[model samples]
Target chain A: MFGLIGNIKAVPGQRDALLAILLENAGRMPGCLAYVVAEDTADAEGIWITEVWDSAASHKASLSIAAVRDAIDRAKPIIAGFGQFIETRPRGGHGLAAIAPA
Target chain B: MFGLIGNIKAVPGQRDALLAILLENAGRMPGCLAYVVAEDTADAEGIWITEVWDSAASHKASLSIAAVRDAIDRAKPIIAGFGQFIETRPRGGHGLAAIAPA
Candidate 1:
């Protein structure tokens, strides 16, 4: 499985707005197994997005989806910067669901 | 639960080595719900460490644990630097086990 953990830095005081936008379209992700948007407790302006996709290709394909693109466009102005973008191969965990064809 | 998504940059060519070290002592963490270590497919020297602890206090306490401390010290040299450090609140998803008391 393809796993992604990204650090998103929102403009000061705009974290909640960005999170709402992320959660709004999260369920629409076609091949996404788990797309979790979490608030960073320590950083008022930061959030952590953890996602699991069937494959790297599926994740890439998500970008082309109109809804995803729109969300990105909508979120762009509030985003201050991006921190780390890393990928991982997932073995298994408690909350992670079984992998299915995306 | 408390969620942490951290960007770890390993020195060039040390990604695998760093992963091995991380995995070796992962299971021993107390109060840990999920601890996933992933490689960055886009960056040769990057890794994403995603962790879920029972609570913020648990995560903070983990740092003082002997094993965790030792692991950190051992892995320090190979660590090139840190990128983004963020925290999050986990709701629920697949593969993630039920939250059990630590």
Candidate 2:
């Protein structure tokens, strides 16, 4: 499975607003197996998003979806900057709908 | 929910070995909602482990499990070093067994 783990830095005091948009947009996506949004305990303005998708193509396709695009637009202003973004190949784990074949 | 996202740098050419130990240890842990082990696309020696647990206490308790301790001891040799470790409070997302109360 395709995976992404990244940190998003929200403008000071806008973390909640940014988080709200993210959660609001976290709805039905065809290949999304897991989409977690969390508040970074160390950084007041930081948020972490961990995503697992069936394929890279599916992840890319989700970007074109209206709701996702809208969320991006709405979140742009408060998103101060991005931190480490790591693309990954998820092998398998608990809670995943399906595990990537070896 | 409590969450952890971090990078582990394996000794040169030991990534697969380290990965094997991790996967081997990924078994039934009471409050572990998700435990994903992934290969870092950009760094050959880097691995990412994203974990979501029912609570901070649950996460802490996991460290005492014999299997977990054994995995850590076995992985220590090949684990060259560590990178960013971020603690988080997960809200809700797809694929998680249960959502944290708002």
Candidate 3:
């Protein structure tokens, strides 16, 4: 599976606002195996998102969805910037279940 | 629970070697909930690690373990550098089991 890990910084005092918008419709995309939005402990304004997709193409296709597009637009104003973004191939983990591709 | 998401870069031509070492001793960490290592699809020499620990204190204490220390030393040479490092507070999610504190 394809994985994405992103580090996001929210505009000062807008962390909660940004997080609410992000989590509103997260993980609704097809082929999404796991999508987690978490609060950053070290940085008060930082947020982290971890995602696993069935494939790279599926992940890319998610961006075009209207819900995702809307989320991006809504979150734009509150977002300060990004830090580290990386992609990876997910094997499997203790809590991460395996699902066969249809 | 506490979460850590970090980006790692492997020395050129040493990605596999680095991955092997990393996976060999990973998840053996005390208080560790989930530890996942994946290869970066974009950067051939890049790696991403996602971890969930019972608490920040547990995570901090893990660094001093002999096995963990040895793994760090062994993987240090093949490691290129770090990218985005962020700490987060994990709630709960699909495929992620919930465990009570000791």
Using lDDT, give the best candidate's number. Answer: 2
Candidates, DockQ: 0.33, 0.69, 0.41
lDDT of 2 by residue, B1-102 (tens): 899998899999999898888877554777888788888988999899888899999888888989989989999999999997889998767667553222
- Contacts from the true interface found in each model, as a fraction, amount to 0.47, 0.73, 0.49
Task: Return the lDDT, model 1, position B82.
Answer: 97
Point out where model 3 deviates above 4 Å: A26-28, A64-73, A80-84, A91-94, A100-102, B25-30, B64-70, B80-84, B91-95, B100-102
TM-score of each: 0.66, 0.90, 0.73
Complex DockQ, candidate 1: 0.33
Candidate 3 chain A minimal-lDDT segment of 10 residues: A93-102
Highest DockQ, which number? 2
Ten residues in sequence with the least summed lDDT for candidate 2 chain B: B93-102
TM-score of chain A of each: 0.90, 0.92, 0.91
**Candidate 3 residue pairs in backbone clash:** A84-B84, A95-B95
Question: Model 1 chain B, poorest ten-residue lDDT window?
Answer: B92-101
Candidate 3: residue B45 Cα off by (Å)? 2.4
Cα error, residue B89 of model 3, in Å, equals 3.5
lDDT of 1 by residue, A1-101 (tens): 79987778999989888888888766566667667777777777878888877788888998998987999999999999998655677544434444543
lDDT of 3 at B11: 94
lDDT of each: 0.75, 0.84, 0.77
- What value does the lDDT take at residue A20 in candidate 3? 85
How close is chain B to the truth by TM-score, in each candidate?
Answer: 0.90, 0.91, 0.89
Q: Report the Cα lDDT for candidate 3.
A: 0.77
Looking at model 2, how many pairs of residues clash?
0
TM-score of 2: 0.90
